[model samples]
Target: MLKLIESLIRYEIRQNVIKERDYVYVRNQLFNLLRIEPTDQDISYESIGYPSDALDPILDILEEQHILDGSKVARDLFDAKIMNVFAKLPSEIEDLFFNLYKKDSKLATDWYYNYMKALNYIRSERIEKNEFFKTSSIYGDVEITINLSKPEKDPKSILAASKVKSLAYPKCVLCAESEGFAGNPSRDSRDQHRLIELNVNNEPWYLQYSPYTYYNEHAIVLSKEHRPMKINQKTFENLLELCEQFNHYLFGSNADLPIVGGSILSHDHYQGGNYVFPIEKAKTLDSWKKDGITYNLKKWPLSTLVIKSKSKEALIKKAVSILDKWKNYDNADLDIKSYSDDTPHHTITPIARIEDGFYTLTLILRDNQTSDEHPLGIFHPHADKWHIKKENIGLIEAMGLAILPARLKTEMAFVKSYLLTQKQLPDEALKHKDFAQKILNEHQIDKDNVDEILEQAIGEVFVSILEDSGCFKQNKEGISAFKSFIKDELI
Candidate 1:
């Protein structure tokens, strides 16, 4: 059966791998691939010793194309090719993914991610260069991913993207209008892009994997209607619903406001994938019971409240209640503002995880109040930390992974060279000199140990970035302020 499925996949690929891949009969053999269903021939992968996956032949062809060279980006390009086949060719493709879920979710999701990769939608080189560091902080032993994935946008392309004179097409990329969008100076061809229609509590939504997957099988679940992001009971309900469908994956949302929100707040969506984060391992530091639901505070720097409950309703209800309360609850002494003038100013970055027949929702309390001294959100990364990451600390970063810009790679290399031999700095290195000098002065870096020290320095900065994003300081005074709030307001 597996062999036949592999053969069918290959045949399907041959049919569309070069030309326009999408056709009415693109996935004619999908249903037959399911062993439980019918097939062209009454055959199976059982000569008794055959590999059950039956993909060896197709893999051989991929190797011929050098797509299997794991260390380089070509292997990822091959992955993109296969995924393009999957995305462009599958019949009733939406349900095909769901059926894969019914058959083997891991297989289905793995394929989906591969397809996203093939599109070059998610650049593999970026994922390949990611530097991981496990550092100790008040949040315990936290692991951070230094994101070197994204390439800088071209100036011409940026200018072209800015002059979008029409919304007649996708209001933004997240809009369903982009399903088969043709390429333009600003927009790329979406002829091979695909989305799976899914129903969450009978409410329709669409699922698609992110091309630049920051972690394993990173996916973006977008709403049917393009709308501003809203965090409420419905958001929790939707996240839980996705968990029920793809329980192997976890789902999270960025806050709805700027400074702490996602880059795309114009469209309502949530990010889900098989990736694990340090926040997942964070143990509960404090908890209190209210209506049979236990709200636990994570010991991390970010003010995360963990709600653990076996009952979905209880978790949702309790989360919404606290969300509403937190929006209005504020203490001047703590410098936490719920609002400025009539503008509303409080939200939560919510994440949903299910295990042991229980639902655990982690909510990071967010306040986007800006001050004269800190024009960005007061809790945002201050100027000192801006040298590392100046972008918003969205849901992914708040969870303990740092998606630093790609420029850091070149800049860091320059800094390392200058420290090792006092070599002439490049024009770009000039901007980073102040930061590099501070490091040189502190560590007195020498050639023998420059690499090790610089690597650790970046990790240390990551910890500080998270701390800057935290509403509560990691210091004893901030801890006291946090506890005071719980005692005075939450409990």
Candidate 2:
């Protein structure tokens, strides 16, 4: 434990989160946490690659000593306890971030992201284990990631978590209260977490890095208050304001309706990151100019309207007008109904960024109304695509990046064997049998190329899924109908 403590301090120093002057102070803090005596023996340290190198073994020793149970939940809680001791105070971090921001926004974010990783708050080591790949498709290079960052809970831990009563102190995971909160079995530990408070369009907001980074520098911007996500004129104004604050990042939000919105609906938030999604690469299918703003129809699967202008106010005004029209839009010919009786069905997954001095806002039209044939929203990923992804096509996926379930990692292995040997899939992967067979019929299979074939097939499935979510089909009639709406309502 002493050796690990020395190594952790050295690692943090190497990462620039700490310095040589604070050696004794940091070591004493850890010793107190472990309830151990101070050690006078000199220890040498080296980086074994990541912070987890020193932290994981320390956590294991704590479990062996019965300081924490050998369960994922317990280990998670205690490890955060250890890391937070080294993390800067929220105020210190905020001060440093703003100081850097005054010079350059990119430098500020770069430092912030590195600091979060250095403190193990971003869990960089585990996120690297996630299965990530990109395959070329008609739209662009569609990204598929079989997420494996989240550890599978053991049955004992699962049972314990199930028995714990729920508490609502934080209200939701995205709430401001999550910072420095000591999580229980039912919640995740955020002891090492910090939030940088910012004002967006005169309203309080906080910025934090996502622990599970699907892309580079994945960030969450959340409201200070607990409120549901609602896209309005103010949403456009706020998005533009956020972009001004983080000029190099793209900010977006999921649709505000069920089956098309993000997993978190109770709390309002937007995700921003430095990575460029496939949707941004899509070409303009057609374009029109009005009121000094250029509106382009994107050639992507999702029904997207790209609003571009030099004036921020002009972009927001036009976007809000389009949004208002969409709320009441209906076209029986295309099976799009804005509402069924009193329940509304139309919304948009909106993305904002600055491109070549032009403020750009992309609105992907979404509807959540269900029919008897497809109870899970007519625009959702259909039943055929459920073998891969059934979750809502949130803002990220609408941008052509698929965050697949962790189960795909194992299920695809079984699928590969079945594809080569004609072996029956296990009960666990039965859902993949038909999809795998389709792959067999489409391409010649061999050991070296089966994996590539399966990956491309998954990419194709993701494309079709996006097409299904599209309010306008990519056909002549569908395109015509879409144009009519823009001409009649928006123009």
Candidate 3:
């Protein structure tokens, strides 16, 4: 089955390559077949040839193979095959084919018609959901804005301000909502002392400490608005300008659903900085160089791909197209509904390559759910989690990265704690817990046979918090330890 798929793909690539090579001859033959006036008859007279009446034989063979019917289908299929075959020929021979069969070929005419139909279908689909943005001039324009509301310094005042209500954990005043406040001083100290020195007076474009500092020089780019849509060409070009000006690589995350752990205040933003420190390291598996494009397969991702390209325009276009295809496939598949978060988004990360004048254009797809695994995998420590134990965390730790747990233990704990204090869990929280539990069960973890013995203990604490606030108050030390582990080993 895989070989058959590869053959189909090769056929498509061959068609494209041929069209690119013998474009002039193909165009002249196509025009003659359609009885259209040539732009220059002198050139057409020189290029055109007698047509080959081979459509009938090809159609008969296809019909025998059950790939065609007596209707226009047979004729259409034959024409497509002819075009594909013509495309594979050398330019000189392709010109001869065109001149020989130009006026006499119904196959070429049908092929042209079918090709236009396919092109139209593609264009229509691309514009179906994006017509408004594409058609409107004003809607496409964008401006960046930043909000610099540094939190209060006094702990009491900050704690008081952190008492804002949250649907996820209404009763917990210092939930993840207070993450910024709890770590703000350390972050600020790092900014004022270490990060500022690194900035080296880089002008208005300054540096800030990233909330998640898995990598050195990690910082978020703020827009004035709290909400923004797609990362447009202007933002990308400006980011590239910054890259050139600073001579540093920039990495960014998308809103709605961020892959690189976005934690802003429901705001529009981008992120970038230097890549001096190692975030995730994996062995390079294979490398290939061709036409200014470098292909690489890394051990971590276990996938084949071009790591960098000379043509930025082509690279971006291809990456966006692949992501668009993935989104379309996700939308069509019921099992992968979570992959599409009711919005389309992209993240472009620039990396300094080993080869000069080239950079790794990392294209990250952003949405509510990342992989098939649950997002909570972010908190799974190597020592405790059963999955990590079974898989050997040494591999991941050696790579210097973390996986978000497929279970929602942290979120569950938060909800249960809130419920114990407030008397009831929110409907949404309960639903998420149920869904997460279902996934756990599918992985063979159930109440009777817990997948991880530790998870059961953690689950009991979560249940206790929902049932009685006194339980959470008694287990404060355990909660602190778990949170600390999450901070150090995961995020």
lDDT of 1 by residue, 1-491 (tens): 34544444444344333233442233343342221354345333323112212334545554565545322232332333333445544345565567777888777787666655544455565567777667665566656566666444466456656776655577788876676555454555554577877888777788887756777788899988989999999999999989988889999999998878999999999999997788888877677876667777778778887888889998898788879888897778778888888887889999998988889899998888888988987888877777777889899888887787777777888989988887788997787677777778888677888877787677677778777777777678777777676656655
lDDT of 2 by residue, 1-491 (tens): 78778888888898889888888888889999998988767977766678889889988998889987789988888889988988889999999999999999999999999999999989999999999889988777889988899888887689879988888789988999999999888889999999999999889999999998999999999999999999998889888889988989999998899999999999999999999999999988889898889989988889988999999999999999899999999989899999888999999899999988999999999999898988997999999999998888999999988999999999999999999999889999999988998999999999999999999999999999999999998889888878888877788
Candidate order, TM-score descending: 2, 1, 3
Where does model 1 exceed 4 Å of error?
Answer: 1-91, 118-121, 130-132, 141-148, 155-164, 288-291
Cα lDDT, all candidates = 0.71, 0.91, 0.34
Which pairs clash (backbone N, Cα, C closer than 3 Å) in model 2?
none
TM for candidate 3 is 0.34
Q: In angstroms, how far off is 442's CA in candidate 3?
A: 25
Off by over 4 Å in 3: 1-159, 162-215, 224-226, 229-238, 254-261, 277-281, 285-291, 301-306, 331-355, 365-367, 370-491
- The alpha-carbon deviation from the true structure for residue 54 of candidate 3, after best TM-score superposition, in angstroms, is 92
Candidate 2's error at 346, in angstroms? Answer: 0.3
Please rank every candidate by lDDT, starting with the best.
Answer: 2, 1, 3
Clashes of each: 7, 0, 20
Which RMSD values do the candidates have, in order? 8.5, 1.1, 27.7
